[model samples]
Target: MASNRPAPQAPFAPDASEPFAYGAPRAEDGVWEEWNPTEESLPAVRGRHRVAKQRGGGLARSSTVLGVGVIAAVGAGGMASANTGKPPVSIALPDLPSVDSLIDGHHHTETPAASLSGVATATATAVGDSTADAGEALRSRIMAQAERQQSKADSRATAAAVAKADQQAAEAAAKAAKEASVKAAAAKEKAEADAEKKAEQARLAALAKQYTLPTSSYTITSTFGQAGSMWSSGYHTGLDFAAPTGTLIKAIHSGTITEAGWAGAYGYRTILTLDDGTELWFCHQSSISVSAGQKVSTGEVIGRVGATGNVTGPHLHLEVHPGGQPTGIDPGAWLRGKGLTP
Candidate 1:
């Protein structure tokens, strides 16, 4: 309602007949003179005065204070932008109160510095929460991968152990089989040997019933092929049975007497020829009970034992010749072939 410009001063009027000059007045200097003021003649004010509305309605603010408020607002906006990685947000300042409102004290306003501080705090809190969540997710993934690796390692170890056990079992089975085979082969060989011995015994029993020895109760004095100076040949060629004089000599098997006579060194002798053309000779006998060309049965009395003709004591000399040959074979072996031990 009041003007800010100052009232114009009344225009100055000079007194009649008084001259005005630009020079210095004389020393008396008692007269007063009026002059008009111009724009150039005004004294310069040092700085600007800006009016601001305060609670009391009228106050003056300096330009320096306004500049500081603006700088603080801008710095706060820049800090928020940098932290959030976005463009700076524009802030709208509240309208200044009208002159009537200020005079009546009816309007209120919030400071710009306080508003910016609240915005920055909220943004920082949101960023921190996001970072914490991401870290938790990464830790979970790492733990899962480690667990999978451990499981695979355990499975591999188990498989190796099973394979080793299987191999050992196979080796043991092979060894047992080899030992069983050796035992079976040995058992088979022993069984075969026993069977062969039993068969040989049976054959000897059958032959014993078909033949008899030449004289009973006699001892063997000499075997076939003995060496002695009393024999006409260099080596004796007969089996000798030593006995008391007149001991009976039997026919070894069923045979026919071919000769019954006294031979030179033999003294008394008898020759019996078998059906198979094998000749049996009884020599050095005390007496001959069989005649030439006589048929004698098995175990029949043929002669008596004597110490006759190139003999040292009483003994029966027996010879064997196949097909009436002059040279004789071993009589002991020939009798054994017929199942006769003597």
Candidate 2:
């Protein structure tokens, strides 16, 4: 490379009398002749010269520059090797001034080590910042994913809780509805029973106005169809009312007296024939108050109870015969059919 330093001045030449001095002209064989030095006449100097000069600090400055260049090159190579994962690259340094030029007071400009170091520092800083940014982004993504998972778990728990609550509410409502239904059915059944009982009472009241008992203060001593030897038939075919002698007997219903007189085994008997042709016979009476062909209203006095013929005590025997049949029917059942109990 071309150097920016000024050319060095030549040294002073000695007189011809000086014996063979360098770069000085000398007379040959004592004959006085003029001589001049040329570029071809000087021999070439080899290698770096270590000569010190008074004007410039020679070897010390060169050593300093050399050390700085070597350090700069090592830094650049090491950085390049580390980044590329390869062998260090060779770095070409700027040519430095030789010792001869330095001793001649010639200076050369060199590249600064600070500039290379600055470039390396800037590149490393950029790589470090990039790595930091990447790590931050990854951490942010992980945190966001964790939050989403937690939110999903919470939603599931809430849904389960709501469903359970709804089920409980539904069950409670169903139970309440079932209970209400049962209560309504029971109320309906009770109301129907009460209404039927009231109707029966009303019917009995109406029948009471149409019929009356045969006698008062009497006890049922015998029922009809009772088997005994005391009766003419194999079974008793009449109802017997036991009472004190002379107790008054009343007509069971509005009827006409068909017969009233003393009978062979029935003592004083009275036969009352209803308008429907049903006959009610009152036997074993102490006295008869109605005569044949006489019309009597219900509850009218008819006869008195007595222990007459074939009687066990003071009782009035009664028989019912529909359409004047020869065989009699049960008198107690016949009385109940008229809304009366015997």
For residues 51-136, write the lDDT of model 2, one tens digit per residue.
33334454456656666666665666565555665544444444455564543334544435464445445544454455456657
Give the whole-model CA lDDT for all candidates, comma-separated: 0.75, 0.78
Which residues of candidate 2, in runs, are more than 4 Å off? 1-168, 223-239, 258-279, 291-293, 319-342
Q: lDDT (0-100) at residue 221 of candidate 2?
A: 80
Q: Lowest-lDDT window of 10 residues in candidate 1?
A: 55-64
Q: Candidate 2: TM-score?
A: 0.51
Top candidate by lDDT: 2
Highest-scoring model, TM-score: 1
